[model samples]
Target: MKTELEKMLAGELYDASDDTLFAMRLKARQLFTAYNQLGFEGTAARHTLLKQLLGQCPDTIDIQGPFYCDYGCHISAGENLFINFNCIILDCAMVTIGSNVAIATGVQILTAHHPVLAAERIKGPELASPVTIGDNVWIGAGAIICPGVTIGDNTTIGAGSVVTRSIPANVVAAGNPCRVIRQL
Candidate 1:
C-alpha cells in the first residue's frame, strides 16, 4: 500500500490527517520559525536553514527570510533565484522553479487544492498538483500561482495577479485570471 506522502506526491487524493504527514508539517513549521526569526545580516545562516528545508538549493541563490512552505523536501529551486520576503509555497506536491527567477514579496505558489463539492471535501481525501516555473521569470508581489500551473521562461507576472492557467514563454501577464497582456 502507498503511504499518504506517496499518494500526495503522485497527485492522488489522500488523507492529510495521517500522523506521518502531520509530523512532517510540524517539522517544517519549526524550521520556518527558525528561518524567519533570523536577522537581516544572517545570510549564511539563512542559507544553511534553507538547505535543510528545501529538496535542493544551489550555491547561488538568495531567499529573503520569512518564507513558508509545506513539505520543503518537495521544493527544488535552481541557481540565481531571488525570493523576497513573505513568500509562501504550498508544496504538497512538487514545486519546480528554475534559475534566475525573481519571486517578490507575498507571492504564493500553491500546489494544494481542495475539492469543489462539499460532499467530497468533507471526506478524508484531499488532492494536490505540481507547479512548475521556468527560468528568467519574475513573479510580482502578492501574486498567486494556482495548482498545476506551468509558467514558461522569460515571463513577467504583474503584481496581485492570480494565475489559474499555464502561461507560455516570453510574455507579460496580469489580472485576476492572468491573461497575456503582450509578448516580450
Candidate 2:
C-alpha cells in the first residue's frame, strides 16, 4: 500500500489531511515563517533555512522571502535561481525548476488540483501533478503555472498570465490561458 506522501508524489489522489502529510506541511510552515522574518542582511541564516526546507537546491539561490510552499521537500531547484518575494509553490507533487530561472514576485506554481466532478470533489481526496520549469526561463509577476504544465527553456511568460498547458521553448507567452505571443 502506498503512503499518502507516496500517492501525492505519484500524481495520484490522496488525503491532504493525513497525519503524516499534515506534519510535513507544519514543519515547512515553521521553516518558512522563520525564513520570512529574517532581513536581507541575514543571508546566511536564510540560506540555512532554505537548505533545510527545500528537497534539492543548489548552494546559491536568491529567493526573496515570504515564500510559501505545501511540502517544501517536494521542490527541487537548480543554480542561479532567483524567485522574488511572495512566491507560493503548492507542491503537493514535485516541482522541478532548472538553472538560471527568474521568477517574479507573486508567482504561484501550483501542482494541486481536485476532481472535476462535484461528487468526486466532495469526497475530500485531492489530486496533484508535477510542474517543470526549464532552464533560463522567466516567469513574470503574478503568473500562475497550473498543474502538469511544463515551461520550456528560454521562454518568457508575461505578467499575470495563467498557463494551462505546456509552453514550448524560445517563445513569449501571455494572457489568460496563456498562448504563444511570438517566437524568440
Candidate 3:
C-alpha cells in the first residue's frame, strides 16, 4: 500500500511525509515568501499560493502572515476558514479542517507521528496519521494539536492547550493534554 507520505507527495492525501517531502515543503515556503512579500492586499495572492500548496482549499479562506507548513500538500481547509498570524501546520498525513473554522494566532497542527520502536526511530523515516477537525470549531492561540486527533463540531480549544487526544463535539477543552473542561 502507498504510504500517507507518498500520497501527500502525489497530492492524493492531505497529509504525508517522505524523503522528498522536505523539498516540496521548501518549494511551498519559497512560494509563500514570494507571494507574502507582495504586501497586504496580497491576501488574495497569499491565498492563491496556499491554494496551490495545499491538497485542497475552499474559496472563503484567509490566512495572515508568517504561516508555516512542513508539507502544504497534506493540508486542506473548508469554507470560511480564518487563520490568524503565525500559524504552522506539519501535515505529514492529511490535516483536514472543516468549514467556518477560526484559528487564533500561533496555532500549530501536526499530523506526523513517530514509531516507538528504537530501530525504526533511528532510521528517521516519517510516519503520519490524519487529523480531522469538524465544522465551526474555534482553536485558541498557541495551541498544539497532535496527530490523528478528531475534534468534533462547535468545539473550542483554549489557548496554550496541547491536544493529545480526540475531543468530542460541543465542548470547551483546555490545558496541557487538552481535556474537556465543560460543554459549550
Candidate 4:
C-alpha cells in the first residue's frame, strides 16, 4: 500500500521534468490569477480559493487573498485553518494540513524534491514527499516547510525558519535547517 501510494504520487508529480513542472506551474498560475482577480468579497473569495486549492476543506477555514499552489486538488486542509496572504504551497504530493493551524504571510510549503546525486540528478527520477502539519501549529511568516516532514501538534515555527525535517510536538523551532529549541 505504501509503495502503491508512492508510485501513484510519483506519476502525478515527479515523473515530469523541470520543464514540464514549469509549464504545469505556469498554467496553475494563470488559473490563480483568474481566481483571485475575480472581484468577489472576502468570504466568497476565500472559499473559492480553498475550493481551488484542496479537494476537501472544513468550513471553519480562511486564507486571505493571493495564495498559490501547483495543484489544488492534491492538498487537503482541515478545520479552522488560517493562512495569511502570500502563502504558497508546492503541493506536488499530498499535503495534509491539520485543524486549527495558522500560517502567516510569505510561508512556503513544498512537497517536491529532486535528486542530489550529480550523475543522476538530471537522469534520476523525481521524488514526491508529503508534508503533514499537526493541529494547532502556528507557522510564522516566511517559513518554509520542506518535503517529507511532519510537524507535531501545537508547535510554533518562528519567522523565516526553513524546516528541513520533522519536529516534535509542543515546542519552538527555528533556523535555516530548523531544529527544536525548547519547550513552548
Candidate 5:
C-alpha cells in the first residue's frame, strides 16, 4: 500500500489530510516562515535554509521570498535560477526548473489539481501533476503555469499569462490560455 506522499508523487488520487502528509506540510510551513522572516542581509542564512527545505538547490540560485510551496521536497532547481518575490510553487507533484531560468515576481508554478466533478472532489482524494521548465526559460511576473505543463528551453512566458498547456522552445507566449505569440 502506498502512503499518501507516495501516491501524491505518483500523480494518483490521495488523501491530503492524512496525518503523515499533514505533518510534512507543517514542517515545510515552519521552515518557510523562518526563511521568510530573514532580512536581505542574511543571504547565507537564507540559502542554508533553502538548501534544507528544497529537494535540490545549487549554490547559484537566488529566490526572493515570501515563497510558498506545498511539499518543498518535490521541488528541484538547476543552477543560475532567479526566482523573484512572492513565487508560489504548489509541488504536490514534482516542480522542476532548469538552469538559467528567470522567474519573475508573483509567478506561480502549480502542480496540484482538484477533481472537476464536485462529487469526486468532495470524496477526499486529490490528484496532482508535474510542472517542468526547461533551461534558459524566462517566466514573466504574475504568470500561472498549470499542472502537467512543460515550457521548453529558451521560451518566454509573458507577464500575467495563465499557461494551460505545454509551450515549445524559443517562443513568446501570453494571454489567458497562453498561446504562442512568436518564435525567438
Candidate 6:
C-alpha cells in the first residue's frame, strides 16, 4: 500500500490528517516561523533554515520571509531564486522552479485541490498536482499559479493574475485565468 506521502507526491487522493504528513508540516512550520522572525542581517541563519526546509536549496537563493508553505520539502528551487515577502506555496505535490526566477510578494503557487463533487469533498480526501516554473521567469505580485500548471521559460506573469492553465515560454501573461498577452 502506498503511504500518504507517496500518494500525495503521485497526484493521488490522500488523507491530509495522516500522522506522518502532519509531522512533516509541523517541522516545516517551525523552521519557517524562525526564518520569518530573523532580522535583515540574519542572512546566514535564513540560508540555514531554508536549506533545511526545501527539497532543493541552491546557494544563490534569496527568499524574503514571512514565507509560508505546506510540506516545504516538496519545493525544489534552482539558482538565483528570489521570492519576495508574504508568498505562500501549498506544495502538496512537487513544485519545481528553475533558475533565475523572481516571485513577487503575495504570490501563491498552489498544488493542492479538492474534489469538485460535494459528496467526494465531504469525504475529506484531497488531490494534488505539481506546478513547474521554468527558468528566467518573473511572477508579478499576488499572482496565483494553480495546480498542474507549467509556466515556460522566459515568461512574465503580470500582477494579480490567476493562472489556471499552462503558459508557453517567452510570453507575457496576465489577468484572471491568465492568458498570453504577448510574446517576449
Q: What would the TM-scores of all predictions be?
A: 0.97, 0.99, 0.87, 0.84, 0.98, 0.99
Q: Of 3 and 5, which scores higher on TM-score? A: 5
Per-residue CA lDDT of model 3 for 1-184, tens digit only, reads: 8854565434343333354655777787887677557677766777788788778887798888778886677777899999999898887678999999999999989876666788867665556678899999999999999988999999999999999999999999999989999997
Per-residue lDDT tens digits of candidate 2, residues 1-184?
Answer: 9999999989889999999999999999999999999999998888999999999978878999899999899999999999999999999999999999999999999999999999999999999999999999999999999999999999999999999999999999999999999999
lDDT value for model 5: 0.94
**What would the per-residue lDDT of candidate 6 be over residues 15-128, giving only the tens digit for each residue?**
999999999999999999999999989899999999999999999999998999998999999999999999999999999999999999999999999999999999999999
Model 6 quality (TM-score): 0.99
Report per-prediction Cα RMSD to one decimal: 0.9, 0.6, 3.4, 3.6, 0.7, 0.5
Ranking by TM-score: 6, 2, 5, 1, 3, 4
Report the backbone clash tally of model 4. Answer: 0
- Candidates 3 and 6 compared by TM-score, better number: 6
Sort every candidate by lDDT, greatest first. 6, 2, 1, 5, 3, 4
Over 1-184, each residue of candidate 5 has an lDDT whose tens digit, in order, gives: 9998899999999999999999988888998889999998998999999998899999999989899888798899999999999999999999999999999999999999989999999887999999999999999999999999999999999999999999999999999999999989
| Candidate with maximal lDDT | 6
Better of 1 and 4 by lDDT: 1
The Cα error of candidate 2 at residue 139, in Å, is 0.6
What lDDT score goes with residue 110 in model 6?
Answer: 100
Off by over 4 Å in 1: none
